[model samples]
Target chain A: MMAFIHHFTKTYLMWNEGPMIWTSDVLILLTSIGILAALTYFKKWKWLWTEWLTTVDHKKIGIMYLIAALLMMFRGGTDAELLRTQLIQPGMKLLTAEHYDQIFTTHGTIMILFMAMPFIFALFNIAVPLQIGARDVAYPYLNAISLWLFFFAAMLFNISFVFGGSPDAGWVSYPPLSELGFDPGVGENYYLLALQITGIGSIATGINFIVTILKMRAPGMTLMRMPLFTWATLSASIIIIFAFPALTVALALLLLDRTIGTHFFTIAHGGDPMMFINLFWIWGHPEVYIVILPSFGVFSEVVATFAKKRIFGYTSMVVSLMLIVIISFFVWGHHFFTMGTGANVNAFFAFATMLIAIPTGVKVFNWLFTMYRGRIRLALPMLWTIAFVPTFAIGGATGVMLAVAPADYQYHNSYFLIAHFHQVLIGGTVFGLIAGMYYWWPKMFGFKLDERLGRWAFWFFNIGFYICFMPQYALGLMGMQRRMFTYPANMGWNTLNLISTIGAYLMGIGFLFIVLQIAYSIRYGERDLTGDPWDGRTLEWSLPSPAPHYNFAVIPTVESRDAWWEMKKQNRTDEWKVKEDEIEPILMPKSSGRPFMFGVAFFVFGFGMVFHWFIIALVGILVVFGILAHRAFEYDDEYVIPVDEIKHVEVGLGRL
Target chain B: MTTQTNHTGEAVHVKHSAKQYIIGYILSLVLTAIAFVLALGHAMSFKPLIIILMILAAFQILVQLFFFMHINESDGPPYHAIGLGLALLFAFAFALMSIWIMSFGYHAQLVS
Candidate 1:
């Protein structure tokens, strides 16, 4: 028992670091305590538990995802600022090398996995069903499970900072360096296990979304007639299902190498580290598309809706998206052309990498032509979409530059690559999601976000983005490699670094205004009484704002490509009208605390595995299985909303 | 209270019999047996042997999918089967590429 206690305290509690308590650590603790106190004081625990923690409703789940993504963005943003501050001047003692490594690694991992992924999934949950005129996802219960699993995996990762040391072998966690001989700590263990768990959730989500989009779309909604956003979701989900398995295999092998003495990626045991790299990028390259493709979907919707144009070249847009997915897998070798994969092999990948630009260019032109002769709204979402075009174009241009096999030898691991990705990811995915949030805010919550404040946020973020990354491209050309904690004063790299840091701060301020905008809007924003807020083109806008619990009172029968637009043209508002006798009781999956409870169990299980406590880990796994068994034996998993109750809801919402 | 069956406006269900499952099982077993025997007995040259084994494996998968899994049944929409087929294609491509890349890595190491 004493030995067990020793292991627990030593391996689990990072609070015992030293006499000096860091300010950030104290802030994290205080913020958590303050949140709990607020919840307790307001007596909202039950409300939170019933409405949020156990929600199977896609809208509520989407809200939870959005909140979590925003919180992760804050954490990742802080890490970014810290990295920037450390690089503000040469010979700065702001952070030690080890701390810098941990910060940057966490920053990258959290930004991509927690922030970008959840943000995308949040949109998926909120919009996909609505766009396709479905009542809910194909598996609402499993949807809750996916969200909670993501939450717990994220918690497992975040707790490493306050409980144990954070993973420092970069987000990629390349082995040999990540192996036990070098790391020998609980950090890489946390990285592998957290990713392994979350990755399963992601795979589940992938399958769930695929089935939902394919099987749950409304009557008369043929494949070609689905909205662009739905099309994008389908393409992205396909990529996720295929690509994520490689990540699962890679992370699992790395875990075994770290824990049970396997050598799948170790240098000495006849294992090649190159294989790990190969597997990582096999997932990693498509993963770039996985995150970005959904954003592409978001942009297509935003551009068409705002431009008041039937999306030009709709089929071509879909073809390009499919083309991107196909070509994404073949270009993983471009990431490692410098490793002497032979000229022929490198040439094939280099050309394949460049081939991506053709389809992407087609998409770009499609969006442009969409706005050519149409009345453009210049709404907040449209502004972000407009900003995305040029910024992502530059990113694509630089991407092609780096794809050159010979040029990559010079540019690889430099700030140029950094600039390129942040340009595409931040400029493309971030902008697109932010636009989606703005566009759909009225639909999700019956109110418009403050456009005045939104404009401020957009300018600051866009300007700050360019200011942050553009100089990095120049700095890379001036021979500044990435991940360096500090440098000699003679390096002449201080000015560009300072400008980049300042721009990062501006972007931080921009994010702050968005927070303020949400808070301010909650109190005083304009209410969207009419369901059709943006004069939107899709089925989502046809429902009342804050759409009724069962999204469509009647599951809408969609007939054209732009189903709602066509309905409006035919003056068909009565399509939503339901005859009194036609009303059937609606059956919905009953919400239960099982998914959240399972999350807690998995967290405990993952925490135990991280500390190598075999019995505790086994117990956690058993608990998870036990809960699954309990759920399985239960037949009454759903409840019917009576016709009278549906009528009551409709009357209350003025939708009858 | 009347027992009201909820109608989601999905297509009518297509039920299958136990005989279909039995046939699928038999077909899968036969294909596996052929591939196993050929590998053990050296029934063909290496290249042709691999090709035949792959063909047999493909047939086995189709039999299982169509017969047992009911890929043809449109539970609501027929696109579920299409999605699965596409997923399988991508998976096959990924596996092939990983092998090709890894083999090339090995070859490069040998030459150097």
Candidate 2:
């Protein structure tokens, strides 16, 4: 019934959408009111702890980011499922084109901007600080703010459904389609404002991570000595710093065009649509690395740990990751092979795209060699890692094919491209994240997840993913386009679509099993965590289960690639520290409700201004300046950690 | 933690500081004001002025990076690496803008 209302409202708006809300908008209005109403009744509003929200602790922020991202994933995933079902039978009338439009757009928006990003960030929050032997990220309060801003953006994206409708202009929101005369709905408004908001948060987070990685390495842990995960993050964060601002500028330009008609990308007004495409892909191409490279890092660590071998070719792996970053910037043109840039341009980009495979292949070989001649433990995480290796390679092979300029003509906009991305994304990033979750679950929480349940989850998920996506390559070859809600049954796509949908359900069930495993482990699972339960190689495994707010009592130094392993081998020396180093009172940022309030401000200003709420926008801008001004004059005057206090704390390390 | 105290004379330091940020901002602001005044005053003859201001702004961002952002003063990685990092971002943005502009095939100059 709700879906029907959403569907009906969307079609009506497609025909006659306005700045104002229609009657169906009231349903969204009512549902949002209902959700907020429940929050009020339960008084969970107070439990929204401003103290916790603004704290500098990476773990808390990472977890919050994950929670927000999960909500987005659910919202995005449901949209996907709906689209798939609509596409199952041609001209089936299950959903109108407008309804399909909203689903596809929101799915891409939420998945990329919200789900994948925050999930990767969750791993960063949990690992980077701990891995680098830093007590906290470089700017912890900023970290908190970045997370809240992201949440605000995610919330604003969803809030569109309530106030009016969400972005139906597609995730890319390509113009003239996005211009006022064409869309002129709250849909594109949400797209610009939400993305602009989230893009700011992402950019700031990128800077924060990059600074942390560069500056906060433990003494003796030079760039060369850093862990693979840290190295991957360094490269990824570099991409983010350089890349996301292009998105920010692009979205800003588009917003200017749509809201005020400034003629940036409009064809009639001296604007260039190809400009938008170029800028978007400049960010978009590296955005793939932003997701995939971190996953590669995750798999490296997993393979090495389970294989009980030193990561083979550590220097080469780091060098390769760096090379990947350098090469990625030159390859943005490959995205627009269909734009008719001529064969020379196309061939140049095509070759650049394939060059990425070299460093990527090096990293792959290094991982495999790490596993060679070692006692390979077939842990669930390791199983996923193994499956991912071959699967991602297949995706890479297809990617190379697509990079061939002539071949891309046949493959562009087809299900083949879709199949290629999903193969890599699911097989690479998704699998790596799942592997990290399993590998670190016991380290993060006190208990180990049920291995039996983990195995079931793995097999089902791995098999189901292939079943779903492998057929899409063939579908692409047969000339089936993506984003079609319905196809002519004679086009030979119905069987593949049906099979894909079935596989999606199986994958869904597998996810459920994993979720169940996490839930059960949280409650009744066995707990024996003196924290280093896995006998892990990294410093993160040295800390207690569910690590404390202050991560390290004494910032541990490095003697070798595996700092913790080196410590054990050397018989637990204070060689972890430099000689005459006196413990200064390590100052941590104070917890304030400021980040949340600032986030609220951006939230109101972004969404409200998009809808042209003059007064609300005014208030929102005031709130932002108000918070920043209030924050600037004050300081974290609370000298919270005293020197003797830290020493005492260090003695009781693992107390958390 | 240390400044370039190795500068031979107080006049040299004073001159570098004066030219680096203080005059840099002034010159940038003047060029911008000139461009803005021309545009606002409706003078098509000041197309040269617009080009001049943009070039000035681009240089100003560089000046600020070197002096205010403290890039050129230090010989260490902090100075060079971060400068390089910022340069990389600039290069990517510049490359993207160039491609975008060129893609329209001189059609932008034709856009009203």
Candidate 3:
């Protein structure tokens, strides 16, 4: 009986011997309880479940993604602050080495996978269909499944912190170190299965967006006439479809090696770790572009609308986008030049890497020319766009410097490399997403984000970004390495480290201000009566702010590059207008609890596998398949919105 | 709720006869048999055997894509063709790059 109790407690509860609970765990517990209590008190469970948990509406799904990404950002940000605080003084023993490893690993994984990917997906959901004048994505039910899969995967990864151990082999999870021989924890198992689930969802998203963009565009909207955002979506989805398969294969092989004693990546059995690196970068490098391309598309839209002119070199912009896509795959080899490939191979990759700058340079000058001799508004989104140019240029220039194979030998794994990537990622992707959020805020909700607070956040964030990373470049030159938890006091790295830590705090404050701004605006901000709040040049602005579930009453036919702008110029809103008798019932997919139930089942399966409980895991798998079969055989999956209901809703909103 | 519309009476889809499917299946089986016999008999040297097997595999793929998958039946949508072409291009690139880089590096290591 004692032995049974010990085994049950150790395996099921994951009760480590000493100090098993942390402040973060307690905080998570309390926050969850508080949320539950509030929901019960307000009697909002039914509203929450029916409206959000089972929603198939693209906009609602996007908002759910936005909320999840923000919560993850806060979690990842706390990890960053902890790192900064520990590094403030030399030889600080605030955290143990083991804990430090887990912190950085989770930080990298959360920031990139959980935060940025979902943030971009949120924008894609809210904006893509609207921009192209489609009523919904091609596969709305599949879209819900994708969101729930990603959500469950993220939850599975996060609970690793409280339930067992966190993965310490870094976000890349390179082999030999991550293998069971060196690190034999269930942490890496969680990483593998969780990523497999999310990766499958990501692949589905790629296919969904690709089919939608290609097939569902309104009449006369030719490929060239498509909005830049849609073009970027198409390009990025292509990359996702092609690149994610490499990740799927790599992860599957690693899973097999760990679980079933395969030699796919095991070094003792004649496996090569470099092969893993190759496969990883094949997916990883393209992933970097996948995150950045949609932001580039956002920048294009913002630059044109704010500048009050046609984008300067539209053909060149499209060409540059495609060129980036083609060139991205050829340059993945540059990531490992220090691994000692032959000079001929290194030279080829280096040249290919540097060639990316040429197309990027064309885009920079095009943005500048668009703003030249044009009426440029200094709106909040435009402010971010204006700041993005110089910062990203510096980032791009440093990128070329590191692309040199010989020079990269010195900068490899140094703070300089860290600084270079953060510059591009934070400067390029983060800034552009913020710009898009602020620009589209009025459309997503009925009110605008408070501009005064937004500018404060903007300046603090931009300035804080520079102050934080610019010195890391110098620190790298001063022989500082990354992933170092502490340093000796007399190494002359104290002052700069302190300054960087200070900058990190300022950025934290900037994020906090944005959060407060959101809360304040939701209650007291002025509402947008006219949907075209910004005098925008896209199809989304043609609808009312906080657009209806069915986006357009009548499907629009495009006639020019900037379709909405052209319609406004010719006063042709009447052209596509439907008479009262022309209104017909619209078919929409019915929302079901299947996706939410699938997520719950996945969590159970993942948790069971983490504990090596094969019986529970098998049961979970069978339940999942049963759900899929149930959905397949049930053909009554859609319902019609009657014409009278549509008329009543539109007339009430004065949109008729 | 509105009554369901019956579109079954409206249009006729093209129907291929059973003979066509049977012929395709028989041809596929014969090609597989020839490839297997050649491999088992050792009728050619290694290099020629590889080339002949590759050609047979290509023929099988074409037959499946045309007959079973109905690639040509997708009418007026050039995007499908373009997407297929792009996918094939990337598949070849992935395979060739993997082989070339690994073999070249392995050979260099051996020489060293």
Worst 10 residues of 3 chain A by lDDT: A12-21
CAPRI rating of model 3: incorrect
Q: Name the runs in model 2 displaced over 4 angstroms.
A: A1-51, A573-585, A643-656, B1-27, B34-55, B73-76, B79-93, B104-112
Model 2 Cα lDDT, one tens digit per residue, A1-656: 99887776665343255432354456667988998999799986766575366565788887777677667766776777777778766667777787788879998888888888888888888889889887777777778788888889888887776456778877888877888878887788888888888877887888778877776777778778888998898888888878887788888998888777799998787888878887888788989899888888899889888998889999999999989988887788888888876666777789889999999999999988999998899988799999999999999999999999898999898999999988998899889888877777776666888888988889888888888888889999999998887888788788898888777767777887887887878888778557776667888877777776677656676778888877867788444432234565655656778888888999999877778777998999999999889978875423367766766665565241
TM-score of chain A of 1: 0.97
* Candidate 3 Cα outliers beyond 4 Å, as residue runs: A1-20, A574-578, B1-60, B104-112
lDDT of each: 0.88, 0.78, 0.84
TM-scores of the models, in the order given: 0.93, 0.88, 0.93
lDDT value, candidate 3, whole model: 0.84
lDDT of 2 by residue, B1-112 (tens): 0010111111133235465667667766776787677778776666776676678667777767765766555432553565487656668656764565356444444564
State model 1's lDDT.
0.88
lDDT of 1 by residue, A1-656 (tens): 99888886565664455432255577778999999999999999999999999988989999899999999999999999989989988989888898899999999999999999999999999999899888888888888898999999999999888677899999998877888989988899899888888888888888889878777777788889988888898888888988999999999888888889999988798998888888899899999999999899999999999999999999999899989978887888888888776777789899999999999999999999999998999989999999999999999999999999998999899999999999999998999989989989999999999999999999999899988998899989988998999988887888999899989989998999999999999989999998888998899989899998788777777789988888888999686666566677888778989999988889889989998988989999999999999988978888888999998888888766
Compared with the true structure, what per-residue lDDT tens digits does model 3 show for residues A568-641? 88999667555577677877778889988887777778777766777888887888898899998978888888
**Between candidates 1 and 2, which one is better according to TM-score?**
1
Clashing pairs in 3: none
Question: Which candidate number maximizes lDDT?
Answer: 1
| Descending-DockQ candidate ranking | 1, 3, 2
